[model samples]
Target chain A: MPQLALNRLRERGSTERAALDALLDDVLAGTLSTVVDGKPWVVPMLFARQGDRILLHGSTGAGALRHVAAGAPAALAVIAVDALVVGHTTFDSSANYRSAVVHGTLTPLPDRERAEALDALSERILPGRNAEVRPMTRQEQAKTLVMAMPIVDGEFLVKTRSGTASPPDEHTDAWHGVVELRTVALDPAPAPTSTAEEVPRSVLDFAGARVLA
Target chain B: MPQLALNRLRERGSTERAALDALLDDVLAGTLSTVVDGKPWVVPMLFARQGDRILLHGSTGAGALRHVAAGAPAALAVIAVDALVVGHTTFDSSANYRSAVVHGTLTPLPDRERAEALDALSERILPGRNAEVRPMTRQEQAKTLVMAMPIVDGEFLVKTRSGTASPPDEHTDAWHGVVELRTVALDPAPAPTSTAEEVPRSVLDFAGARVLA
Candidate 1:
């Protein structure tokens, strides 16, 4: 597929490879959309950014994954809202967000790379988790399917909106500002079957890094 | 298109109308996927849930919006992750999330209803702002395109995962639990051009409601 040119709000769109990589790394999950039998099918999945490609994994039996493995064109979108831009008119009110959409074909990772891809995914979810946790068994690896889509330049588009809303035409003592929004990690709740009494370093680190700014 | 059956992890799938409604209302933005000329295109958009339909608005000149208005089959997905499940193994870890996918065709709202739909979109981004802000201008309404997709019962699916991960076999004193994640609203930053010194009630109420929970 060719690069998607931003037809509207061109100021907010970019084709920078760095920006695309940063967005894929910042957002741990994305909505993967694919064409199956000429119909659009979209599903949210957890993904990890691996170099120039984003890795997506699911059960081998998943119908959507199967369609992608069969060379269906796919598009993955990651969006993160930074703030709410409040203006003096309903038309000016909007959100400040970073959105990236990647268009490509998915290729199933070979069996030899599945374990490493899984680790990258695990690390994305929880940094330093692979070393702390037990390795995946062969049976488990066999049941999972890992796929990668190349993040070629010009194959993705990144659009971002920031700053305050456009100044109102006739200001009249109306409040206008930006309300920053962030995803924060709260305290952990131990599972009933957990034997460990204290939170692990990986969990603590992940939580600590996500404190409200 | 027929309803998508959950081929894998059937236990996590749901067809309840209430669940689908709740997920759509909770997530302010979603990724809209549409097939264009036998290829997939996905874009992140801010939407409002109006009764049994989702209202999506954008510039009238947007290419994607035009495609949808031209009778493209589209799927909008809203996903909110509640927590990160930590387990003793990488394969066992996952995220607790509520995901809803609405599959339908987008219909452009009539010109008479455009202003109302824009208000709904604004209210979703900033509650109670309609009363405080001025009404949208005629030109603003003319330049904007508002489309609605019916959230029919059988055409949508909601899947959710909650609580902690499944217990690990042969435990080795690993920390296991869920780290709750929430989208929080921080202190508002007034625009430099604003004449008002005090924050508006609408912003305060919205921020207060989004504190860590």
Candidate 2:
């Protein structure tokens, strides 16, 4: 439960737990940072949040995930980019984003919990997907490694940059503000043999209520 | 110049140097992971490729960058999320993405090269922005810390997953294909006091060629 100190850009760092959860739940992907053997690695992995713990799954044979399960230190970073803040001056320009960094050791999930965790991940990424897809067989489950890292009390950082630029330079009379961007799901492309008339409801639901700029 | 070994998901790992360069050049943002004082940190930063080195700049007072400058080992991961591959089964669903992971130490850029690096970054993120915006003043340059990590011969990995799932489950009759996703710049919102009638050509150019879906 120790707090992770923000040693730089303290003004932009937020300790709000809601902000952390919101950022984690919204982003679908993140890079997992950990050391393997003697080399450092940043591995990209899909992640979903379950209560106070973050769920991450990968091939059971992945060495990086195995090391984390064995109690190696790790950090998972999820970033939701909002827009590019174009400032009147190059020095003042910055990207508008909501980023969360969580640090903890991952533990392997039990069989029963792992099943639910897999469904939870599907639901998070593609809502209503658990019902549309076939259940995972035992052999498939065995080959998958499901792990969770507690959203430790203070070992995280949430930083966000939104709204207009911090007042443009006085000498420059150029325009400045955020050019908003949103990630909306595009129409699904059905496989060659599939007969579905369109993307299923689950896919539609994922793009629901997008914050339009 | 030795190749970094692929220790996990060997099937998804790619060793082609061109693939690494292409992924790095296309993605605008990446997380820089480094260890400082025995604690791991994954800090998000904007990056651009210049020949054999990756250019990254931040505030001079930032601790994470300072550690990298002091020769702490670092990995910069750039990922371009291409799509979400929805499968007939929950277990088969996965995302389509191109990711590049580079491992190396960072060295601070000297004065002259630092200026060029800043312009290179601007051009990469916002093409033609260097000419569109006012020049960075000397004092502004002094407070900004620019650094580069050499793109070693084989100390990098590029992995990409595109197209439909690896043949869906035979028993399930669900649709399958990638739900493409792209990051396109939105209309620029000029500040309330600004006089520009429309977004600059550079901003428009960035989004012009997007494959609208």
Which of the numbered candidates is closest to the native, going by highest DockQ? 1
Native RMSD of candidate 2 (Å): 4.9
Residue A23, candidate 2: how far off, in angstroms? 1.3
The weakest ten consecutive residues by lDDT in model 1 chain B span: B1-10
Candidate 1, B198: how far from true, in Å? 1.9
What lDDT score goes with residue A50 in model 2? Answer: 86
TM-score of chain B of each: 0.93, 0.89
TM-score, prediction 1: 0.94
Number of backbone-clashing residue pairs for each candidate, in the order shown: 0, 0
lDDT of 1 by residue, A63-175 (tens): 77799877888998988877888876776677788888999999999999988988888887788888887788898888888889998888899998888967868746788
Q: Give per-residue CA lDDT, model 1, range B26-78, as digits (tens).
A: 78778989999899888888888989898887778888779987788999987
Tell me the TM-score of candidate 2's A chain: 0.89
Give the per-residue lDDT digits (tens) of candidate 2, residues B1-213: 000112345677787889988887766567888886555678877778998999887777876678788788899886666777777777777777777789999999888887777878777766777788878888878877888999997888888877776575485568776677766666677777666677777767755645211
| Candidate 2, A48-165: lDDT as tens digits | 8989998888777777668878788889987766777777776777777777789999898988887888788777777788888677788777777788999977899888877776
Whole-model lDDT values for every prediction: 0.79, 0.73
